[model samples]
Target: MPSAPIKAMIMAAGRGERMRPLTDNTPKPLLKVRGKPLIDWHAEALARGGFTDLVVNTAWLGEQIENHFGQQSQTPPSIAYSREGLDFGGALETAGGIARALPLLGDVFWLLAGDVFVPGFEFTQAAVDRFAAGGKLAHLWLVPNPAHNPKGDFGLGADGLALNLPKDSAEPRFTYSTIGLYRRELFEAMPFGNPQGLKAPLAPLLRAAMDNGRVSAQLYPGPWTDVGTPARLDELNQASTTY
Candidate 1:
């Protein structure tokens, strides 16, 4: 079967509390890595991959994001914003924000965190075709555990299924790269306007899919950094000079 057209969502709504003082005024995504805003790197990657429609959700210091990108420009994807009000404050966690922006995302889309810096991964047309044909709820990019996140997020079997880490497993783990494609069905029961996190709601669904041989993941080997703190930001900035 032919795959549906692709669109992407950049999750940029976090308050970046750990990145405080800096984030006290500028949103994490708006902060510069090297010389460009953090979100610019991902936006350029998406556009290069031929994804045109992009949705970016914002809350803390959102006006900056809107002002910097405006409606759309020639160099980046045509961007749209799903503004989360201050009354709710902070972000709507990953799942809730996706749920709230379903209309913009439609049935399927790619989800990526705004704060992470990666040296671009291989997103082949074959993979996109497989995702569109399989009808799986989500497909994630997994990387070998980095020093900063040793415990890791999900466990992958030889069969390509991604299982939630067992409570007692002591083996090496693979960290989620904060990038993936998601189908709308995964958020059918997720509630909006609350402090719900993505893990609690999506883990079970991912686990069940893994057990049933549905969920899939691709092991990515490349430079990946989560610039959540000042230290990591500095590290990525230094690393960016060479890349």
Candidate 2:
């Protein structure tokens, strides 16, 4: 088995524009997917996979998140927070959020978007081992593009590296599942010390690194859903009850 990451982070700072009303009072990560918080699914899975420490970035009703998980305890991995807007106004976005949390993360850590609902995707030790040995800065899991995002994020090359290409090009593009293993150095260029929040997207950083062949990727065949809107959330809630 490959060595497991010592620390990890879950991106829970989105405003949930499409998940309004439900998110009006609650942060999206705190919203239940099948009787459990979306972030809990990731926390439970990471703990089961031997990850002991977790950092969660929050904004847009972040207090609920900190109050819920901070006041209580989760096993295996003790939980912590990287608040983006206590002094600031809104979220720092993905790259900025991760950069702010860099101090809390280790050299290599696990990262996942808090809102994605992916059932049965395991953080295997073998994948960890493969990444530890590969010397790549990032290891991503790409899934088939969902209807909402027919044009995917990156393409997987024959050499097992991630390639950024236009969806209409000959390369096969897959949607970014928002689950990945990343290195701290990748966010070195992003500012972190400001309380006002460093705002930026994560794609550009990944794309720049891909050009140097520093990112690796693999296709994941599993039940994955990006619960962006209320309609999708209702569908998942209905589907999950059957099982």
Candidate 3:
């Protein structure tokens, strides 16, 4: 018999402060790019890759999201929601939201932000298999630093490990694509990730892991856009249909 499909989590709880008026009522994940809800692109891609069990953590007008995907076809991934806004009274940040959704996920799972536009990304089982075999706590996909973030978030070492470089370091760095495969130990082994609700950011945990060489990463030379601003959204819509 075939193995069970891998589980994936799409982080959709961000308030989209940058998008402002557009996100005033609708959540960032529901914003459209190429005439489709940003999160749908991710869901379709993941489903095509055999990741049919999906968990979405939502806040900031999250009810719309729940209603939007209500009774979606089985061809798309099945969604189990982590209603952060209702349960925590607000968004729980990244790490905290993941922790809240931990009960719905598996030992190893795929993670990505719902607002990013990477239409070309393929969430393949081969990639999951490779990550599972690597024994690393997390495997991240890094992209060339975008125009808005020239400084970048993390450095990629020659050994395929993520580097926690100093801010003043003059090394080449890349922005995290918000796409990754994570081992449960990365969150559970830490003090956080409890289902009881602990609000925290994810960068510190990743940085600490990078320091210990437990995080691996690779450069993704695909089309990607962090659709954070209205201008960026407009740009994507006006640009290529190829994306």
Candidate closest to the true structure, highest lDDT: 3
Give the Cα error of residue 171 in candidate 3, in Å: 1.5
Candidate 3 positional error at 210, Å: 0.7
Deviation (Å) of 135 in candidate 2:
2.0
Ranking by lDDT: 3, 2, 1
Candidate 3, 109-224: lDDT as tens digits: 99999999999899998888788878799999999999999889999999999999877789988999999999888787535445566788999999999999999999999899
- Per-candidate TM equals 0.88, 0.93, 0.94
lDDT of each: 0.77, 0.84, 0.89
Candidate 3: stretches off by over 4 Å = 1-3, 71-75, 189-196
Q: Write the per-residue lDDT of candidate 1 for residues 183-223, one digit (tens) a residue.
A: 88777776542344332334566677667666788788888
Deviation of model 2 at 107, angstroms: 0.7
**Superior candidate under lDDT, 1 versus 3:** 3
